[model samples]
Target chain A: MAAIPRLTSRLRIAVTAPATVWLRGAAQSHTWNRLSGGGDRPRHLDLATLARLRLIPLVGFVVAALAVPVTASATTIYAASSLSKVVPSIAPGNTYSFAGSDTLAFQIENGAPADVFLSAAPLYAERLHSKGLCSTPVVFALNTLTFVTPASNPAGITRVQQLDRPGGYRLAVGGKHVPLGIYTRTLLGKLGLGRALTKNTVSSYQKASDVTSVIALGSADAGVVYTTDWYANTTKLLAIPVPASAQPLIRYEACVVMRPGSDTTAANAVIARLSSLAGRQALFNAHFGLPPKT
Target chain B: MTFRTGLFLGGLVVTLVLTFLFLLTPIAALLLQVPPRDLPGLLRDTAVSSALIVSLKTNLIANVLFLSIGTPAAYLIALGRFRGRPVLLTLIELPLVLPPAVAGIALLTAFGAFGLFGSTLAGLGIVLPFTQAAVVVAVTFVAAPFYLRAAISAFAALDRTQLDAARDLGASEAMVFRRIALPLAADALRAGWAMAFARGIGEFGATLLFAGSVARLTETLPLAVYAQLDVNLDSAVAVGLLLLAISGGVLLVAKLPPLWSSAAPSSTAGGW
Candidate 1:
């Protein structure tokens, strides 16, 4: 303990020396300007002014050096909200897992240190691919949007059209930007119930899980969530299917993000696993749709 | 310093340099990752705006509610003689120690739609989960203890003679509380408020599990930040910077002399 302070003082001196030299250069420039009659006298000068100015650059360098390790070691992956149920099941050995397509897409575009990207909807993935975030992504699986209600089924919603019925029964759907909610909206449009459903929609969530929780908890009379989400939440919910004509195909996609010069082996492995039979089985077990050929 | 001391000092300097870089890199990256031209457009996003508004509104309401109910309870606990005071204090502080996720689960188990009161609430046509109200409740549960603990300490620090002096001067119980006790405890109240606000603003797990991250409804800034990261990493950084800016502003406000002065010892000790 006694030696600690002495050591710290020496360390500070060593670290601050370069800054002090830079400051001296700045001071000399000021003096040269004054002697040459370049302009008015320097605004202010103090004994350690050079050290203080140099300190800023030294701190900046130190901060930049420290950040390199964290950026290199971690890979951020953006996934859809529905993946909240699936990712955790597979993420124990993997490097990254984040939910919500919009959130993920936003982060990746903003230059977060992300290596792999998955989205609930093909549109966002395609958008990123078009913008050169990655090569063209492959459709990995499918998702089905369904209505869920509490076990008691208080709203008695038997068909897709009933959701638009003239009643005060609350409905929860994902936000307009969320894939599941977009699909729900598309389905409603196809069924000619869009206007009515929009009027009665009480709340919109960022993730399907939020919608499912509302229905499962009986907060809303009904809510739209993915088929897999309903399966995962069996204890508190019952899934209700929309009519065939109104249902839209929900495709999941994945892409290997192309960093400037980094290796793509890890991303390729993820893609291969997703395409393989074992991966399909895992998806099936999680109640996600198997790719058509599988 | 001896050569050994000098060598140790060198090592310490290197470690600190590395540590400073580790902490500031992400924040620096957040600032640098965005194109200056795109920032305004990103800030205009409806989802981002709504989440920010919801976060601020909910945190404010939760802080007020926590302060109002927690202050008197803390005072009673701190000043009154009770056999189970320690146990009650511990219970009040229990939520503070639990992980936010666990707190969320506990809230769900007790108040979820299928929880103990779920059926009862349902029968009464009341819903608690996945609403703005749930967000407020979750924040309050996690943040109340900070205020309560601080308030208790502030109340305990008061000199009893001051209260006696107020009473002897013919001030009623309510007057004494208003003029003397409360003034003495102002510092604790402000500290408690700052703590509660900070905790409430950053609350995530409980809000996610209990309130549900409904866009434009229950989604807070952190949820917004998380959601952006899911789809667009750049957007996430932008949103994160926005959150960081707000947090920094709040911290500055909390530390300002006007706010800090209220908690200063002399002014809070029932000074004339």
Candidate 2:
């Protein structure tokens, strides 16, 4: 207990070193098995098996290491989609990941360890805050909701009012609980196209990226996704911004998730950098609207 | 023992120990997490019941499809002399090692509404993606290989002399196969079907991606478990336990003797 800090680092070192060696051995044995089919040794194995074996350990290491409660020197910040870019730009040395806002919260709820959570909505962070799982939430970035269609325009959808037109149009949207889904539903109702547009729905997938995939693949006629999602796929998908009057402001919030005896100084520092002037510029450059004035 | 044999035995020991730890521990613990008091309520849980209903129906169809198409393919591989047989076997087994996510996307690319063959299916007014049919397709794609591989092995293991003897006794090839080969391989085929059925029922990633997880629409047991994981873990555990129970039943059914007498012609199913 007294040598806790030292013990944890040593444990990490031990786990990774042997795990890598065993993984390599596993790869060799796999190749040997394939190559020496029906023998004491394998004769040949292709590059594909080698790649798969390499990825298994690497992914296992990441997930295992994160799941370990022992916090090392680095801070693990789980940011939501649009904020993924901030890690490389603002804090290159930290362990950063961008999970869907709902997924990150759910993971944390189920005991995923993270020092900081940068979420797409304050609702989740506030929930965690109320439960004492995280610090008070701070609003950071704002995103606008929009709809998109494949560039091929298979449905010939040209306007917001056209969204409701009867053309056997299939629509894709996020889960009902997620921020994007709530916003998309509100926008549809406000435009009086709620029943018409949502009725021919194929599926309400997990999150924003799923909605993007459905539309991008031309599986659905249109998808309601975040404006940033449209910007990211400018070539593939045509962005149709929601009418400003009906547009709901999506506020992305950040909070430091609690960890016993873990040094949160670095996590706080990372959050501070995100709200900094440079971070603001970086966010805008990446098409995120600045956090609204208090 | 020679040094090399000693090394091999030592490696095997380690392998068995590690495999047991990695595989059994999680399953044992997960099942144990289902409270004893919660056992009776598993059937009463709406989500669990609905998901299980979907799983049983889709998997039954998928396995029937497998037994129809895949059984013959397995028999051909096992008995037929053919060129490029290794290539054919490898092709059949390719999906066995595919990551479920990759399999899901692969199914989508080939069968989605705008997929390569999707437009053709659509022209006939059939939309597979996000439908119950898509779930069956995904299960068939992933589970058929399990059945085929096992069935092939089962067929291949038969004594060829018996086949030849029956043929020499003035039995037609079909007669020889029906009387001699079918009963001999019946147990193996049942085992294979059970494995494939279990795989189909346990499918998650591919089904979620290809069929979409709409509650009571395409949401099978695995999807229901996922949806309920963080929200209502008890219900999730109930569904998982149900799957385990079904899997156990499948194994037991496969292991038991045929319900009818083995000597009867009724026991012989399908062409040799």
| Per-model TM-score on C-alpha atoms | 0.70, 0.78
lDDT comparing candidate 1 with the true structure:
0.74
| Model 2 chain A weakest lDDT span, ten residues long | A47-56
Write candidate 2's Cα lDDT for A1-294 as tens digits: 334334445444545455446544554464344534725544364323533334434545667887888635778888876566555687678777676787889888777778899888888899889989899899878888877888787778778677655546667777676777777888888888877544564466666777787777776777788887888888889876567888776888889888675447877888888788888888888788887645
Model 2 TM-score, all chains together:
0.78
- Tell me the tens digit of each residue's lDDT in model 1 across B1-272: 34443443465589799899989998887788898688878888888889989998998888879877887777788788979988998988899999997888788878877688877877998678767889999999998888888898888888988788778878887776677777778756776778777778878888877776666778888778766654566777778777777777776676566643444445323533
The DockQ leader among the candidates is: 2
Q: Which candidate achieves the best lDDT against the true structure?
A: 2
Report lDDT (Cα) of residue B192, candidate 1: 72
Instruction: Give a tens-digit lDDT track for model 1, residues A1-294.
Output: 344334445545666566566445544464434533546544443424535544444555567877876545444555676776565455435666566776677677767666778888888888889999877888888877777778788778777667666645667777666787789888778878877554563566676767777677666778778888888888888777777777888999988777675347776776777777777788888888877763
Where in model 1 is the C-alpha error above 4 Å? Answer: A1-98, A105-116, A260-263, A292-294, B1-61, B98-105, B122-125, B130-132, B161-176, B201-205, B212-272
CAPRI tier for the interface of model 2 = incorrect
Model 1 C-alpha RMSD vs. true structure (Å) is 10.0
TM-score of chain B of each: 0.84, 0.86
